[model samples]
Target chain A: MKVLIYGSGQLAQMMYLAAVPLGIQVSAVDVGNHTVVDPISKRSLELSIEDAIEQADVLSVEFEHVPEDLLEQAQSSGKLLPNSEAILAGADRVREKAVLSKLAIANSEHRIITQVEQLDEAVETLGDKLIIKASRDGYDGYGQWRLAHIEQLDSLKNTLSQLDLQNVPLIAEKMVPFERELSLVGVRGLQGDIQFYPLAENLHHQGQLHVSVAPAPDITENLNQQAQLAFKKLVEEYDYVGVLAVEFFQVGDSLLVNEIAPRVHNSGHWTQQGTDTSQFENHIRAITGLPLGNTKAKGKSAMINIIGCDDYSTDLLSIKNCHLHLYGKTVRPKRKMGHINLTGKTYSELAEVMTTLAKFLPIQAFPKLLDEADKLAAID
Target chain B: MKVLIYGSGQLAQMMYLAAVPLGIQVSAVDVGNHTVVDPISKRSLELSIEDAIEQADVLSVEFEHVPEDLLEQAQSSGKLLPNSEAILAGADRVREKAVLSKLAIANSEHRIITQVEQLDEAVETLGDKLIIKASRDGYDGYGQWRLAHIEQLDSLKNTLSQLDLQNVPLIAEKMVPFERELSLVGVRGLQGDIQFYPLAENLHHQGQLHVSVAPAPDITENLNQQAQLAFKKLVEEYDYVGVLAVEFFQVGDSLLVNEIAPRVHNSGHWTQQGTDTSQFENHIRAITGLPLGNTKAKGKSAMINIIGCDDYSTDLLSIKNCHLHLYGKTVRPKRKMGHINLTGKTYSELAEVMTTLAKFLPIQAFPKLLDEADKLAAID
Candidate 1:
């Protein structure tokens, strides 16, 4: 089978790696350059986008922020998985909130704004201290505004007025004081059979995933069920046919939907070594209509992201149970370079390994560094 | 770091997968084709044996049967890990016996013969009913002769005399009735630190590994320790660096060395999903002077080879805790196509997954079919 992946990035590279062993050929298109290249052959194939789509058994995107025209054209080929509706919901916060609301899932109360004048009503309805987000092309703390006070809301709205809100709308949401963030990575097949990986507790630094621990330590069975139910509702509503990552905020015993990623999410990286089937492979299986694999956890696993820095302390290799994965990416500041996965039979043992990993990681970015250090040092 | 692998097969392909994540470049040359190719690029590059030797950071082989000239060239490079001496001992039965005798390792008593005249003395020294084997280029039940009676010995010797035994001698050995077969796959670094994976109970069909279960079932702790000690002794004796898989036979309470593979062996495939560090990554680490990885078994694992068939029962995918890994090889009869790795908390659970896998695997070979069925049904 041949798969055409839009966006030539690390995720696409990894997908290519997973596809190869399945005897699937994957070709990538760099939408930025409008060039199609075979990842394995490193051969530049001069073909029209229509020809590429015509040849592919499936058309997919590495990121949801693909050009709408390209997605529409690809969709016209009747080969795209997770389809344009799913991508739109992932790319636009307004559509995402609407989807959640339609499903009656718990989310932060929010209103959409097409102009600066709507900010007054948004603040009145949601709150004075609100997060004003651009509906599309927003990620990693970009294209968003924070209103600390009612006086500041006007200036934030005024600043937002200069941009073309015609192409993109604004979503102002009430900020919730959540204890911690968690995510559920689940796959739904074309047959509507849903498989949920264990919920993962995620830690982010500067709006990028830094660390994720699977089975989310101290999670109650009821909460897990609730989360899974919420995920199923969203997947069924979308008629999703691939992996969907639903980010959540744990407010007391209840969880609030934070966001949804249409494709495999970084928070599920722990599943690569922790679960019987990796999220990447499961996503491919779900999209291809293959039987869903075992989602059982192998052990307690933690994944630490290697962000921005290309060079990491090779000392991490010295850690007995750690598995380092470096994406073949050229380094840049704040960019996700790769990740390290550590597995242990016990949660505390895995925590110890993560503590050792934290030292080799950029300490400042890892919020639990000091606590992890104290805990690991105490063990010795 | 760059590694030059001598054989191009599934093992080399897996090693390539593991190396890429570590940013290690592996260039492989198939001895059969005598052509070098970069696994990642899939590009065939013309390289003389001398140039390959000169350019490599370390030299290793996926299989033991590399040509003597190429082994000598690799050894002359002064960068061969586990060295030609170790590899030669593995490739030739005569050399292996000599090494075992010198090390005082328990092995079947054997005699080497260069001429048909030696057959009379060989039978007198060993036995009339003996296993006669070509000293080199023999594997997977090939290049071997079995004599049931005295009258058959002369005819076998006469047939053997037609071959050029000048380059390849023959070894006649007394057969031992063993309880079961086991293997220890371990690694030794240049720093002399060694890490041993848990002993594996192996099952072979037609002299090729069919399945391997790690932390060998129903074994005493003392026996496991003895196996580890034996493996350590071999590693130290060879001054071996990189992974070494030593096959053993259990007779009563004692273990005898059967054969050794100087590189990663097929029986260690369970490590892919059942260990903290896989054999492939650890081999790269050991040879590259990187710190040895943890080899602790995560759970009970069973690896079943998918040989000679491309179409398998997809129902196995529905089995919990079963992980299928197809090597992307174009199908052919009697060829190792891929393998499935099954892991569970208990041997019985792993056996259950194995049973499900057996139904999917095309059981063309009688020995494999019977053994798999028996293993599956006996697991209750």
Candidate 2:
């Protein structure tokens, strides 16, 4: 079986690693250059994009932000799993909000704005406290502005007016005082069967994910059902096949949809060490029309992103149940170089491992480690 | 870091898979032609053998039977782990027996025969009930003969006289009635730290391993200690620094050494899904001078080889905790195609999973499945 993934990044690399044992060959596309490459070595394969698509049994993307022209070409092949529509919904915030509204899925109250003048009415309707975002190509806290008071609205509009709003548009969301950030990573098989890994609590620093803990502590049964229900409605509506991630904001006992990612997600990386099957493997199985492997967490696991630094001691592997996954990339500030996965029987045990891990990592690069470790340690 | 392995087969392929995440790149030598190739795709690399050797930080092997010339070349590089002496000990039964004698390790009662006339003395000393083997280039039940009575001696001598006994020699052994076959797979690190996975009970069909159950049922503390003691003695004797396999025949409460493999063995494949660290990764770590990962088994597990068949239903994955590892190979009678790994919390549970797995496999390809499953199910 041949799977052609559209992005030659860490996710594609991981998918390639997971696919090999199942007798699947994975070739990755360097979207920046339209060159096909081996996911591990990034060495270009002697094949054109058209030839790769022709030979592929299935076509998928590692990220939602793949170029539209490439996505359209892949869609024309009739082998793209989850389809381009689902991917577009993930890429465009306006489309995502529309999908949630169409499915009657609970999410944050937001309004689409295609003009700079719309910001005044957004503040009046969503109150002065709002988070305004670009409708497209915005991620990791970029292309966003915060409105803490009515006085900041004019300046935010002025900043937004510097760009062509009508082309990409904007989403003015009420800044919700959510209790915590949680995400549910699930896969929908070709037969329409869905399996979900337990919710993972996500910790972010400077708008990038730094750490995630699976089977997030203090989760209520109702919260889990709410997350799954929203997930089910969205995947069913799109006839989605493959892994999809839905980020959520918890308010009291309810979960409000924060965003959706139509790919194997970073929050699900914990499954590599803490579950019967990983999300990457499940995604491949879903696209290949195979049975989805188990998604149940075997134990509590924490995934700590190795961002912007590779200076830490590799001896951290000496810790029991600790595993490192380096992406074989050179370091750059805030770049997601790789990640560390630690599994333990309890949240406290995971925290202890994380604490030990923190001692080996530079605190400046991993800003959320100590705080997240403290929170997990306090869990019963 | 880079690792170059001799023998481009499934073991090398698996090592490549395990090494990628550790930021280690592995290239394999197709020993048949001295070509360096990608272990997964088997594509010939752009580099020559000399260049590959120069680029590799460490050299190793996936099997002990690599040709002597290649072994000598690797040894001269001073990068080969376990050393060529250890590998030669595994490849030549005569040298292996010498090592056993030097270390005072208990083994089968046997005599080395360098001439056809020595067979008469071997028969007298080992008795008529014997198993005779070529001292070199023999494996997987090949190059062996058995004698059930004294009446067969003259015919065996006539058969042996037609060959060059002086070059290869022979090992004539008294065939003992053994209760079971068990193998201990372990790794020795750079600093001489050793770790062993629990012994695995092996079941063979036509002298090829068909199934292996790890943390073998009915193991007493004394049995485990003896296996580890023999392993420690051999590794320390050679100053070995890689994964090694010690096969044993259990006679009453003692273990008699059957043979040793200088690289990852088939019996240790169970570690891929059943333990915190797989033998492949540990071997890489040992050669790269990194700290070894955990070796403790997570639960009772079984590894069933998929030999000479691809007709089984992939739906076996629907069986919970079951994983398929298909080595991309053309089917041929008696050839190893791949394996299935199943893990469960108890012996009975693993048996139940194996029974479900058996329903999806052809009986001819998995000759020992039902019997082994029955045995495991009967365990308390």
Candidate 3:
């Protein structure tokens, strides 16, 4: 079957690779070029976006930021999965908050604001230390405004007023003093059979994922169950039929929903080497109405993102438990260039290798280096 | 750089897949097609054999059965490795015996015969029960004659006399009652840097690899060391500069060399999901002069070949810790269609998975099914 994915990024590239072995043809829409690139055929062709949408058996997105008009067109084609509604919830902070609140899921209290005048009430209700997020087109720390005090709120409010919040809307939420961040990636088939991967502890630097360790360390059984329940609730509530990633902030024994991603996610990269079914393959299975695959961990695995750097220590390969995966992307500053996957017999052993890896990886380029190091060291 | 492989089978296909992520171009010579096919580019073109050899950066074979003329031409290009000399040793039973004897490697006693008249001496030297094998183009139980008793030796000799043994020399060997079969897959670079993957315990059915377990079970430290030493000796002795797989018969604590494969072998398939570096990727690195990757096992892993039939239990994907890798080939009887990989916290867990997989797989087509079942059950 033919699958069409929106956005031609590393995720799309990997998904393309996964699909090929299953004899599934995958084509990607380069949103920048408004053209389609057949990953298997390596053939580029110009076609109307609607025609491409109609031609594919399934339409999915690599990320949540596809233009709404194209998504609407794809929805009209009756093939867009997790569907535009689910993707919109992920794309817009307001919709995401509403979905969480509607499901009685814990999240930071927030107010949807469209104009600068509303910022006064937002700050009064949400408090001085707050996070202002554009409801659309924001990722990797972009389109976010953080206020540390009341005095800074005025300038932030003015900055927000100057932007086109009228077109996108905004979410001003109280800053959460989270102890750590974790994520639950689950797949839901069309038959509503859902499979949840173990919660993954994630460390981010500069708002981009730097490292993800499967079966998050020191996680209380109660809190992990809560996260899985919240994830299941969201998937069933939305009738989501693909992999859904729910980001959470751990506070003592409780977890608060931080965000939701309606497709295969970065935090789940460890599954490629650690799990029986990789998130990419499971996503394909979920979307194709095939049986959801086993999500059990193969071993303790840690994934280190190779951000914005083309040159990596080939010597990492010399380490006893490191697997280097270089995404075929031209390196650019702060861009996700590739990642290294290290699997070991135990979490502590994996952590030790991660420590060795940090020595060779540039800390400035990868913001979560110290955090990743600490997590690995603390795994025991 | 462009690499041209001499055979278009699953190994070459996998190599092509691995090369794509590295942005390397790969084309394969399909002996069946008598032409070259670009695996990724999916472009098929005809060219004079000489032109194809000259166009490649290096020439390698997927199997050892390349026509003598083609081997000579490729060797004349001065890029064939581990060289025609090493390949001939694998291809010709006579040459293989000579190499083993010269190296003082432990192998079954054997004699070469060019005519039926020599059979009486061969029988006397080797024993009553003898295996007569053609020196060239014999694999998977083909091109061999068996003598169960001394009385039958003359009839076998008479039957062999009808053929021109001069044109096709045969090697007679005493049957070995090996305890188990094992293999060590290692890679050597031109600069003499070497890396060894852990020894693998292999179970074959119908003369085909049915299942392979990494870090061979019940392996004593001394035996493991001996296997590694033997592998190092063979690779260094041959000046091998690519992946060399040395098969052995583990009789008690000792290992008798069975044969050597100059390229990636089936027993190493567990590396795909079990190792820090897959054999396919490491072969490319060793051949390309890149730094060798770590050969550490991700976990205790078992690889089960999906032979003959195309249909197998997709249910294996539902079981925890199972990876289904289909080769995207149309299935036919006795054809190697694909394989499944299972990785677990321990060997016993891997064995459990292998047993569970066997129930879903058609063991009748593969001769080693019962042995695989026993091995899986012995995982503890």
Candidate 4:
């Protein structure tokens, strides 16, 4: 079977690796434009988007932010998985917020603003401390602004008034004091059968993900049930198919929905080491109408992102149970060049392995990792 | 770093899959003649073998039976890993027996016959009941003859004299009444570091491997130590620098060395899902001078060969913890198409899963699977 992916990135490359063992061919379109690159071959072909889409048994996106025209064309072929609406919902904050509201799921308090004048009311209604996100094309701390006080609104409004907001409205959210961030990566098959990897605890640096520990160290039955309920509601309502990653903010005992990624998310990378079948294989299985694989975790796992550093050694493999997955990318500051997944028989062992990993990573790019190591050390 | 493999078969393809995630490009040379084929691209390129060897950072063989000229050429490059001698040892039964005797390892009582007349002494000295094998290019059940009694030896000598035994000599052995067969797949790094996976119980049909169960259900520390010690002797003597699979025959409480494969062998396929890091990845690491990953088994495992069968369903994936690996080869009777690796948290659980797998497999191709399932059922 052949699968076509919208983005020729690490996610697609990983998918290619997972699919090949199962006799499936995964081809990725650069989405940087029209051209399909077989991630396995790293070979690019001058193929039209339509031609590529037509060749696949199923069409899926690595990221939700694929071009609307391409999504529309793929949808027309009836091959687009998770559907265009689900992708748009993930791409735009407004659609995402609406979807959460319809499911009666808890999210940060927010209001939509289309003009500079509405910013003043949004500040009053939501709060002075707010996060303003552009409804579309926003990610990794980009296309967003933060407000700390009422007095700051005018300058922010003055800066905003220079541009028209009607085309791209702002989702003004009242910042909440939360405990920590978590993400649940779940796959819903075309038959509507659902399976989820254990929720992964996420740590972000400069608004980009740095590291993730799966089965999120301090999880409870209640926490798992809460995430499952939200996932069930959203997937059922949208008739969702394929992996959907939901980011959450934990406040006291309650979990608030933060964002939805309509494709495989980085937080779930630990599945490569910790689960019976990885999230990539499950996503491929889900999207291709194959039976969903077992999501049973084999052990505790930590996935630390290798940001911008290509000089790292495979000496990390010397650390028992540490597995390195290097994405073939040119080095650039803060870019996710690769990730190392460390698995252990127990959480403490996993934590110890992560602590050892922090030694090999640059302190400048891995302060969070160091801090996490310290916390794990305290427990030890 | 790039790795050039000697064979463009399924083993090279799997190594290609494992290496790509570690940012390594593996170019496979179809040793049937001189040609380099990128297993992933499925594209063949006509390149000079010398240029290919020089281009590779490391050279390794997928199988041990490459042509001597090719091995010699690769050897001169100072890159052929595990070395040409190691490859030749695996290829010829005579050399293999010599290595075993040099290590003082036990083997079935055998005599080398360079001439047909040696058959007369072989029967008188060794025993009447004997199994004779051509020292080179013999595999599965081919290139073999049997003499049940002394009277039969004259007829066997008469039959053998129909041809010459100059280039291809025979190893005639007094057949041992063995209980079962077992194999140990171990990797030796450049730094002399070594790790061994637990012995795998193997079942053969028509002298071709059928099914293998790791941590061999009935195991004693003595049996494990014996295999490890023999492995240590063989690898140390050769200064081996990659995965080596040693096949053994069990006689009462003792184990006799049957054979050694100098590359990733079919018996180690269980490591793909059963261990922290697979034998293929470890072989890649060993040759590249990278740190070896852990060989710790994640669980009990069974690897059933998918020989000559392409009509198998992915429904095997529906079986919990079952992983399908198709070689993408055209079906032919007795050809190794691929394998399925099934893992479980315990021996009993693994037995149950293997039992379930037997249902999906053709009885003709997998009688051992049925027998194993019946045994497991009896235990249940």
Q: Residue B32's C-alpha lDDT in candidate 3?
A: 73
lDDT (Cα, tens digit) per residue for candidate 4, span B1-380: 89999999889988998898788889999887578987765577556778888889999999888888888889999998999988999999999999999889988889999899888788889989899998988888888888887778778888777755888888999888899999999999999999999899999988799989887877898899899999999999999999999999999889999889999988999999998889999999999998888887777888999887776667778899999988877799899888999887776677888877776777677768867755644542
Q: Output the worst ten-in-a-row residue range by lDDT, candidate 1 chain B.
A: B365-374
- The prediction achieving the highest TM-score against the true structure is 2
For each candidate, report its DockQ versus the true two-chain complex: 0.52, 0.90, 0.38, 0.76
* Per-structure clash totals for the candidates: 0, 0, 2, 0
In model 4 chain B, the worst 10-residue window by lDDT is B371-380
Model 1 C-alpha lDDT per residue in residues A19-57, reported as the tens digit of each score = 656656678888887778755333466776778888889
Most accurate candidate by lDDT: 2
Candidate that would win on DockQ: 2
lDDT of each: 0.80, 0.94, 0.80, 0.87
Candidate 3 residue-wise lDDT, A85-182, digit = tens: 89988998888988898999999888888888888898778788888888888999998888899888777877888888788898888999999999
User: Candidates sorted by lDDT, descending order?
Assistant: 2, 4, 1, 3
**Where in model 1 is the C-alpha error above 4 Å?**
A36-55, A371-380, B38-56, B221-226, B364-366, B369-380
lDDT of 2 by residue, A1-380 (tens): 99999999999999999999999999999999999999999988999999999999999999999998999999999999989999999999999999999999999998899998988888878899998889999988898888899888778778888889889999999999999999999999999999999999999888899999999999989999999999999999999999999999999998999999999999999999999999999999999999999999998999999988989999998999999999999999878999999999998898899999988888788888888888988995
| Candidate 4 pairs with clashing backbones | none
Clashes of 4: 0
DockQ of 1: 0.52
Show the lowest summed lDDT stretch of 10 residues, model 2 chain B.
B116-125
Which of 1 and 4 is ahead in lDDT?
Answer: 4
DockQ score for model 4: 0.76
